[model samples]
Target: MTTMRQLKKRAQFLKAARGRKIVRRGFVLQAVAHNEDCDLGPALGYTVTKRVGNAPQRNRIKRRLRALSKEFAEKFDPNFNYVLIGRQEALHEPFNELKKNLARALEKIHVERSAASHAIDRKSKS
Candidate 1:
């Protein structure tokens, strides 16, 4: 089982927020390439706003996100930093469903990234 590197700084989370964002029912996933440290593997950060719930409820959302991160660690791109913003729905959602959503979200992020790069390549060639 691979353990993901944890993002500890506020700056790290904020930087990811400026990158690609994928919104799902359970949570929001933000990902950005960290060119400075690609060899460290993917780093993960979790945040739950007060609007979602009180202290205990927010903590539960973070816990569920941690589990999902662990299960999909290898699927994450090593060069990217990711932040997961927990939503209120996360607390009531089934674990299996959350897992499926996460998988789909990751796939979508990479696909979009590749498509964007292809567009850039075409522009440079013209």
Candidate 2:
């Protein structure tokens, strides 16, 4: 039952860009393991730029992304920071499909991260 912190700083978003990324039909998800040790859950950020649409459309996309984050918050690792970048299709995409894609994205990110860490461990042991 961990609550997520909002990622508000510019640097926080930039840092997350260096981590694993999953692109979906409606959005792109980026996750980076946090360096600082803290009790708070994963930090989350949402972005829907002018490239997607006008102010109203962008707002709609952001709203959907906010809901998506809340629904999938538990799916993310507690030590990671995540950013969801909304696409133009997000405005018209079905909610259920969006959720499905997000779930898949989360699974891929988790798998990739674990594999990377395992590789590092193997390298150190060699």
Kindly list the per-residue Cα lDDT of model 2 for residues 1-126, writing each as its tens digit: 668888999999999999889999999999998986658878899998888889999999999999988898778788899999999999999999999999999999999988999999999999
For the record, the alpha-carbon RMSD of candidate 1 to the native fold, in angstroms, is: 0.9
Off by over 4 Å in 2: none
The window of 10 residues in a row where model 1 has the poorest summed lDDT is 33-42
lDDT of 1: 0.94
In each prediction, how many residue pairs overlap at the backbone (N, C-alpha, C within less than 3 A)? 0, 0
lDDT of 1 by residue, 1-126 (tens): 555789999999999999999999999999999976676788999999999989999999999999999989999998899999999999999999999999999999999999999999999999
Point out the worst 10-residue segment of candidate 2 by lDDT: 33-42
List per-prediction Cα lDDT, in the order shown: 0.94, 0.90
TM-scores, one per candidate: 0.96, 0.95
